[model samples]
Target chain A: MAVVSGSAEQTVAHTPSTPATPGAPGQTIAIEVVNLVKRYPKATTNAVDGVSFSVPQGEIFGLLGPNGAGKTTTIGILTTFVRQTSGEARIMGIDVAADPMSAKQRIAVVPQQSNLDRSLKVREVLTFHAAYHGIPRAERNARADALLDELGLGDRKRDRINRYSGGMAQRLMIARALMHSPDVLFLDEPTNNLDPQSRLFLWERIQGLNARGLTILLTTHDMIEADQLCQRIAIMDHGKILALDTPAGLKTLIPGGVSLELRVRHAREQPADGASPLLAALRALHGVSKVDETGSDEQDTSGEVTFYRLFAPDAGALIGPATQAVLAQGAELRDLHLARPSLEDVFIYLTGRNLR
Target chain B: MATTTSPTASNLADVAQSTPPTLSLIGGAPRPKHSRLGLILIAFLAIFRRDLAVTAREFIAFLIQVLVQPLFLLFIFGKVLPEIGAAQAGFGAILLPGVVALTVVLTAMQGVTLPLVLDLGFGREIDDRLLAPLPVALVAVEKVLFAAIRGLVAGAVIFPLAWWILGSDYTVRTDRIGMLIGIMVLTALAGAALGLTIGVLIKPEQIGLMFSLIMTPLLFTGCTYYPWASLGSIKWFQILTLFNPLTYGSEGLRYAMTPPQHATVYGHTVTFAISTLATQWIYLGLGGTVVAFFILGVWLFSRRVVS
Candidate 1:
């Protein structure tokens, strides 16, 4: 292997070519999925059912779901790794099913798992990937080196992939995917197994790449990751997209913006016997939308230590009524807090359960 | 809705798209069955280095498995076969080439199959190769080639050991050396071809069961010891051996090494060569075809399984 000038840890300043602007709306469709359906022959239910969406050029689109929700399945169809039983997926106006090679040429895929050859140095991984894109040998090394520097893998370029930490291996995978300089990239849970710092660093690199005019389509079970990175996200469940919008837009699907969290303080009291009176009065509060039990009921607890996550439209006003109601009931207040509606709320609203 | 595109984005897309326009410089379609000679050499060297890296990590096991198994087989045939009065016209000499051929074939086959099973089951290394834009068939081809080289090395290592153990009593004709090489290549290829088929067909979890059920049975029935023609009275056994590609491989190897007078069946001299070649070609061709099918199966299966 030819050694390059820079050390693996050398920080290469990456301006990223002015971070390409988002593609113009109504210009042309980069990807279009129409009523996609996929069913494994012996499987009881369709893995992907009647899913449809479109990605305009130069956008960071996210498909968000918990495990078994078919987010990866949908990406597989778009990437041409799997054929859809029924539906149409077109990349750059080219139908994937009709002409996979042409569609494949327009995109790159970074799978969830690290698949680098353990025997190969990190740089060879990128170069070999470039070779599959039919990139000329003379140019591959230069481009691969640049990508390594850009992805912050410059220092580890010569090390065998097996020597890489999980984060390092993931960055190398991203670098290999970008070696061809593809128009669009498909990242399937690209940060699945990274540490928090590594995840944040990878997210920054991903953002930089997206800003450089690469249309990125990613899937993840992480609501936080999706909210932080994706400009638009689709919340999918049971093979169907329940809602598609910006993260803030999805959050708005719930009735209230504020959530009032409560703790019942009696160590050996039954909220059920006395909670009914308190619940009715709390429900009658002016700004309260709904009060729902979150954890164990006061009666079931060894001591009366029930916790409830409440939904309220106005925490400013609702807190006053809630406090007064508890005082009137003569129940000791353990803790009471208020916060904005979270992605978990949106998930509960759509799927009737928490994400995990 | 037209919402996201910017001038810079179009400019970047234009640049990325322009690179592929020069693809016509390399002719498209009907790519060569084997990688170019340069790539073949590189692939051979690279795969060997990779195997050695893996072997180095488990040096003790490799020494026993790759080196000792063949040595033990040679010991039994050379020292024990003659001592037990089981000699049939220089059986030790005859056993030497057969064991060498078997070592080569089995090594290559194991080299190809074991990694493949690991990839398919737990490791998933092969899936990375599948994702590469290279034709799926090339992956299978690379594996067979790797096996062929490994097999040759194993055969070379055993050749001298066989000579030392058998001594001067090892009387074998050197006139058929050219044919011996031919038989070696054929046997190696046939074994690799069969390995490829099995590698794809069996899942990783089933690998152990398959070794016992399929590979072990095939090896035992392959006429590894006595020639197929020598089983004349056992009509059922002879007919059964004909279906086995390895039987043809072993017989062909013996025919190439042994002189005409020492040949067990005179009538089979011409017929054996033609049948061996025919069976070997058929198995090799079928093996290649099956490999293709498996690639398709794996691609589809992964998609379906994941979804």
Candidate 2:
């Protein structure tokens, strides 16, 4: 469980300190969720079980996992839309369950689905949301107009939400969530069903928001999205976080930091030995960490080719030595490639399965 | 994308030095401008205004739904019966208050309850409203209040229509205008409260069952067609109908709109109780039902929506 002292602005609602005022960059915690658990009625297991993490101010934090992995439930608990079965969540240092109104005042949620009111025009959604946060009429209008322009929805301000496409509706949700200028923005799978073009557009917008110092907690099953956007990620599965680190740091958890693969043809037939001499020669190379052989009996009509995988801490430096060692063993190398471990490799390494 | 300076960011920074940039950039900035209560009131009005706008846009459908049943009832009891000599000349006057009462209760119930069920069920549009920074129970009350106001409007539409269509068969005495207004207000409130309670309690699939089992019985036994005093001959029905909140609403409107002598005059025909005592009891019953159901609705609604 991560615990932090409540900020003065949060403790005192009417204080001069506002939620949006920038604190010293890393000193304040935007969201602190402690040992959170949420179990539905008659359900045998908790949807989110003993999950704990903290998102620092101005960071793009991610909860990455497959579907039904409790990512949405955790977001729901943090945003005060759903209560936790047990444990605590604090938004901007205010306890979510004990004082949900204060917690709500400090955060906004863009849920997985488009929860916008279809009856209202695009601008009305933002205006009404601002009004709910107690913004005056003129200020709300200005904010609504500004937000619509910011989100690239200015031309469609008068359009009803029912007419909006999936991507447009999602942008509207984000615009609406931003209307109150919440300190912490919870986006649960914001780009789940978007086309590639819209998804890239949203990614840029999200990066801009984070650059402006918004504390963003987003959930996604897309490893590439998490790697590209999140400053730090908690890889979760089965309602528990399996790993937590930066994308690069997580990739290091693989047995070998990089994998080097070589397809070779023997220069001459070798005398029978317990193990292939080429494997032993590659393992003896200076920078090589581990060696793996893929046995393939079938070969092209011209010659028999064997594949060898060499694990190395620094595959770039070992390339010359590895190729030389293969040549000294009288093997002709057909192809050679160095592959750095990716986030997907890290996920598979940790979970023993690919992210669905 | 073009870079534009955030207006809220600058204004919020001026108001509070410690305000986070995220807050200022996303929303203008939070200041000590409004008290906690004031903020709550603003949120309440925001939600109320949203519902009002939606109801206004669908005003034609609302009018048709609210007016149809009452119009048919008035046409039958007030127009057809008297013309065909199947009922007394003044019978339309006796049924007039009941028609208004029925309209208020049914309209209010349907206005609030059906939408609530839909909001909580398939639509889930209520989730957006629930996200507002107010107590969950207060939001539930706002729904009831909005529905109550709509109920009053339904009554307004029905009253003149009932009078005009019922023709000379009915006469509404304005001697106790204050009492008449008070009764109408109380009836609207009671109707809204009841609707809220039922809306929160029933499953979406049970909406049809609610009309068949609960609404149909309440309407028939609510004295919409005749006086409660006239039900004395059927002793079991009088006892059974005390459970229906609409009965008190209809009776209260009957006492307020009809001539006072009619109570005793009608009493002679059915062995009715003292007029003043009956009227006071109806008032207390309506008020009590409103308070009870309002509290229950808030509690249940908050529990359901929040969880």
Candidate 3:
């Protein structure tokens, strides 16, 4: 219910010290959403509630959230597909609500679901899309050819889209969206339901597009996808952006920098007095920040094994000491894993629940 | 070992390295610059062409659906009724215009309504059209225009069929060519407007009911089987039938295609009233209805689809 206005420029202007965040300082904004709200007919709540963010030109920005988190709704509003109840949005400095046609001319959208005409051939889909943008027929043809060859869909140009697989259909959709050389592209869950190989292929293609300086706004709930692909991400939930920063920047928000998980056997077999000693010894390590015992149903019923997670500023450096500490406790080490806090962990830390 | 890249990967790499090109597909060559009006025109044509291409691809289905009912009606009413001596010798002439008008209504209603329902409900293909850089109302207008063209085509197809089947008995006056063309165009426009309105108003599930409750009543009361002058004996029915846009269309066609000797002025008062102001009222009614329904349809469509 909070109406936050005039915050888009400030939010995007607060440049992170982290050199990893993409986009140079003072880059022109490709998209700016300010306190956007959309209340569907007869709905009790807004689908997108007072959300604001900006995507800098040439940056691959991500709206990361689970289903019904308003990522798609926000995209819908930016693309002029859905009207907002209040506030403003601009695409390439053109107000979307005030002059949608001009805004639409500069942008292309790949919806979460496939909306391509199934009856049209792959080439026709691209050609028609370009035509919609007032591209000349011959030019559209050449563009379609280049895009088809680029997307690895040249062989299927003549084939009806009905025969295409899920991956092929998605690639075709991307090719169609690119035909107009839109200044900004909005991809809503572009990789949803794709096989792992297809997802990787698409990722590489998207990366290549980004390298060429096309501003992209991508919506996804896959934390790894966002972490790997997005230069900056806005973690959204319940129609609100809970946090917005580079993936690495958001990961840094976690209290302890990294997590260390340890599995030990024979620790539970010792008297109950042994448990607290093991935890205290792990916490007593030089770089260790926090330690907690986590229950696992897979633990041996005969008290043969137990699991413990240790948090530290640097799990890599503490791994050797943490292992010796468990051994000194008279417990046999079974397995161990050290990982820097991930975006998912950051999300969990912020929301008090898993992203799913 | 040296790493190798696939051909597809290399092509993608080439694309990435190449300078992004301006979009040239819209006009023939990429223009250095384009006016906003020029862009809108291109976008509109693109949408129109796509719709036509898709419809043409399904020509067989359209032919079957559009031709069978009207052809059957023509054969039964124009051919059989007169052949069996159950009606006047010139009944074919009377029935021919009615058949054409009916075909226009049905063709347009189905053309606009069915596809719209499918687009909104099942296929969701309209989303692509809506994304074009044009006003949302323009998209709705494009749909109506296309449907009107289809209705005109349906009328053209039914004309020759009815004429051939009815033989010499079916003879339309060619003397009033301007009036004939005007009425025909107006009828198609009115049909398109009505179809567009119904398409936006009715739910997909209610389509069958629309045909039963709306279309059937329209055809039966639309003066397809009788001239408007014949309804004078039944004043209430005459007034009720006026609510049907097709009535004006059918009556307009009758006035344009039939001679004065064969024209029905059976009920004196109603017939005299119609004849005195027949051309003016019919033209006004049809033109006015088209305008009203088209605006209403566009308004409703923009509300439903844009939001």
What DockQ, between 0 and 1, does each candidate earn? 0.11, 0.33, 0.33
Clashing pairs in 2: A20-B19, A20-B20, A20-B21, A20-B23, A21-B19, A21-B20, A22-B19, A22-B20, A22-B21, A181-B27
User: For residues A200-273, what per-residue lDDT tens digits would candidate 2 score against the true structure?
Assistant: 88887786676565778999999888887777788898899888777767777887887888988876664566
* lDDT winner, 1 or 3: 3
Residue A178, model 1, lDDT: 72
lDDT per residue as tens, model 2, B90-111: 6777788888888888877777
Off by over 4 Å in 3: A1-21, A264-281, A293-308, A323-333, A340-345, A352-356, B1-32, B56-61, B262-277
Residue A14 displacement (Å), model 1: 34
Lowest-lDDT window of 10 residues in candidate 2 chain B? B1-10
True-vs-predicted CA distance for residue B105, candidate 3, Å: 2.1
TM-scores for all candidates: the values are: 0.71, 0.88, 0.87
Candidate lDDT scores, in order, read: 0.66, 0.78, 0.78
> Candidate 2 docking: what grade?
acceptable
Write one digit per residue (lDDT tens) for candidate 3, span B52-77.
99889988888778889887887887
Q: Once superposed on the true structure, which residue ranges of model 2 sit more than 4 Å away at CA?
A: A1-26, A327-332, A340-345, A352-354, B1-24, B27-32, B260-277
Model 3 iRMS:
10.2
The local lDDT score (0 to 100) that residue A39 gets in candidate 3 is: 88
State candidate 3's DockQ: 0.33
* Candidate 3 lDDT score at position B231: 77
Candidate 3 per-residue C-alpha lDDT over A108-207 given as tens digits, one digit per residue, 9 for 90 to 100: 8887778887767678888888788787777788889988887888887888788888899888888888787777788989898999999998887876
